[model samples]
Target: MIRFENIDLAYQGNNVFSDFSLEIAQGEKVVLLGKSGLGKSSLFSLILGFVQPQNGKVFFNENRVDERIVWNVRQKVAFIDQEISIGDYSVSEWLTFVSGIKANHSLSFGGKRLKELMDFFELSRDILNKDISDLSGGEKQRVAIIVSVLLERDVFLLDEVTSALDENLKKKTAEFFVERKDWTVVSISHDPVWLKNPWVKVFDLEKKTWK
Candidate 1:
């Protein structure tokens, strides 16, 4: 349930988007595809209110994404960045800390759910006790993904989420999101694992449109 109406964005002296428009229906899985510097990530920033558009508007679930409603929009959307950073806290401590936040207090993050996600992601339960900084890149990626899943948000903005994972894990990650017909997912990735999924609609930024 996201819509961008004739959006125009610029960075420094360069143009990122010019009269760009797109609409993602509820429960739709759309993948952003293009070479670097095409403003794929900027699209997400526009929707999340991290960057302001010079023209037009962005709407989430019919509400305009502005200062007043941006926080609410963020609370309902799970954003997973390519570089996973959880500070230096141990995994368990980090998860506990985030779960205690006022925004996420209502969601359940019990041991069963934690273990289940770890298993599904091919991660070991022991990782929960490891320091986040000590984990490998791939391990950190899975951990970040686990946090997103535990939040139970219906909308996801995944930016190169599977960049560090092997082929099998990448496929599993793509399948995990694509299979959720009730969830709205907008992902940025170059990995063929996601491109091969029939349910995912590809939006080529080079062409400035969706296929």
Candidate 2:
């Protein structure tokens, strides 16, 4: 449901992408694998309208992603950046605030749902009461993941989300997303655990093609 056509992106005369094109169908799971500076994260920015290409267009579903419909597009996509930060608010407060947002108003954000996701992710229930600043890197990562899942958005753009987790959690997290047949997951990760799932397609950004 995401397509890029002949995209040309650059920063301060440094070109990152040139004539780049890719199409991700609905419910497809793709992983971006490459060294740094390959524009892997830029692809996500293009889809979210955070950045625009100088030449070519980005499309989500059937519509072109432009200023007119960017907000609408963002409402349906969940982007978890490499360095996730929600603010200093307590976990419960953050969830409450997010649930009250206009786009997420319809999604259920209750104690049971939070508890279940926490358990599945091996997070303690007491973490809901802890401030974001108090949580470790791994905890913050898992919490960010939980928030994304709770938003119930079918399209996910995850950037190195498993970087802080232990091996077991990394495997669990990868399996969880890959097993969800209804979700369109595009992730950028150096962790090889994601490659263990035969269904996860790998795109080599440096090569500008799928591996």
What C-alpha lDDT does candidate 2 achieve relative to the native structure?
A: 0.91
Cα RMSD for predicted model 1:
1.0
Candidate 2, residues 78-129, lDDT tens digits: the string is 8899997777899889989999999899998876887899999999888989
- lDDT per residue (tens digit) for residues 118-170 in model 1: 99999987888899999988899898999998999999999999998988999
Model 2 residue 145 lDDT score? 95
> What is the clash count for each candidate, in the order shown?
0, 0
Off by over 4 Å in 2: none
User: Alpha-carbon error at 163 in model 2, in Å?
Assistant: 0.7
lDDT of 1: 0.91
Candidate 2's TM-score reads 0.97
